[model samples]
Target: MFNLIRKDVIALKYYFLFIAAYAVMFGLFTVSSFSPLMICMLPAIMMTLFASNLELRNKSMLFIGSLPVRRKQIVLAKYGSVFVYLALGIILAAAIRAINEYGLGVEFPLTSLNLSLSAALAMAFAALYYPIQFWLGVRNSSFISFLVIFLAAALIGGIGNMADSLTFDMLPTRAQLVIGLPIAGLLLLYVSYRISLNLFLRKDIEG
Candidate 1:
């Protein structure tokens, strides 16, 4: 599992470049808002690149599938890697927030209800995005098609003020959401793993 996470982080080198760029922009803007938004992209980027195609291309899945490891292990390892990334992002963001507030005199909260909510948003994204990656194994047209659809929907929503119209405030408060998101994420991940296991067992690891 550790090795799998190591491989995942290694594959994320390029993704970190985007993260670095986001960091610079946040500093320029002197706002933590964008910072959390950027970190929330972790799952999307990871799924699109590493989780989706990686296991298949690298044959890690095949190798693991051949071993005594259960499908749950594979799913759990992927979730574990994302959690590590999320933790790292949170820590780094907090550090930067501290520096910006203390050193730069930028007003950013060390801990905020907003940040808490954003973190939950990150989990939701992670929870929803990964199973497609796990099951499709990257090169499958289904994943690509869904990716396109999701992007298009987002773009169209952006153009149409759908975000503004949405009643987002009705959801749980930040504190509650923070606790709820991971529980929801874990449930979704388990469901996804079960689906993936059924599919994998019914299909071909080498196919």
Candidate 2:
């Protein structure tokens, strides 16, 4: 399972430099208006898509299916890779946020709210994405992934805008939100994993 998780990372090793550069460029370009959440979450989402595309193109799943590992492990590894990408995104975003906040004199900081929201949003996205990807196959799921990405971007942007005007007094306390969202996201991911595992077990791997 760990090897499967590492395979996704290793497959994208050459692209990490490019990903970092893109993160920096994206942060600089959108820092003023975009939510910090976008910076933190988009990379994870995009990398998952890229990894899927790569795996599909290489027919990696068929090879993996022939190995000793169970379908359950494959599903778990894929789900685990989502977090690996998320952790990478957070690190990259934190660097960008630091530069923006201190070096560039911008006010955007890596608050707990931003971190929790990023985790929640990314997990929610994985929850929706994996089952579809497994059910339809990666190539067939491309259109759906794009639509999800578009909607996620729009939703997060709207949240960023709303954050400025919304009063915390009417909502749950900051601590509650900080705690609740990630928990919700994890539950979503668990449900998604079960669905994906079932779909994968039933899938026929084409050699």
Candidate 3:
């Protein structure tokens, strides 16, 4: 499991990506709050899906299945790798936000909430993509699936905001954005994992 996790982590070109994402976050998005981090998550999701795709493409699943490990363990490790990567991204975002606040001496607005929200979104987005990649083989379904997911998120968010004023405002901003959003995102991740595992078990491991 440790080796599998390490392999998954190393397989992703994270350093170069971090440099690119960091540049955007610092140069253009230094002051902007959620948009930059939200936008950056798009790539993180793609990279994570691609990492899983690599294993699929290279026929690692068969080898993995032949081992003594349980199928759930393999799925969990993949999910765990996504989590570690997302955690790293959140840390970087926070560190960059701190630098911007300290260097410019301006507080990063919505610091904790935004960072947590971004981490949660990134994690869930990555997880959600995996089942599509697995079930549809990443070749056929990924383009349409990703397109629909993007559009759906945009539409839902827009609609939610539009109704926000009229909707009963029960939770504080800190609770809603900081705590609730992540919990919701985690539900998405859990669904993704279950669906992906079922798909993998039912379909050919050669995939």
Best by TM-score: 2
How much lDDT does each candidate structure score? Answer: 0.58, 0.83, 0.65
Q: Candidates 1 and 3: which is better by lDDT?
A: 3
Tens digits of lDDT, candidate 2, 1-207? 999999889999977887788888778666654556777787788888888878878988778878999888888998998899889989988888888887988776678898998899999888888888888876675776787777767876887788778786766788998999999999989999999889988887543
Model 3 weakest 10-residue run by lDDT: 34-43
Q: Which lDDT tens digits does candidate 1 get at residues 1-207?
A: 777677777876776777666665664464755555454444344444444455556656666667776655666676677667666666656666777878888776545554454454455455555555545654573565467447545744673585466587754576775577566656665675566556555555552
Report model 1's TM-score to 2 decimal places: 0.68
**Per-model TM-score on C-alpha atoms:** 0.68, 0.86, 0.75
- Residues 1-207 of candidate 3 have per-residue lDDT tens digits of 677788777876655476557545653455565544654354456556567557756767777768898777777777777767666555555565566667767555535676666767676665666776666764554474566478548855975787676645653566667877778778888888898889877876554
Rank order (by TM-score, best first): 2, 3, 1
lDDT of 1: 0.58
Badly placed stretches (over 4 Å) of model 1 are 13-18, 29-32, 40-48, 51-68, 110-112, 141-174
Best by lDDT: 2
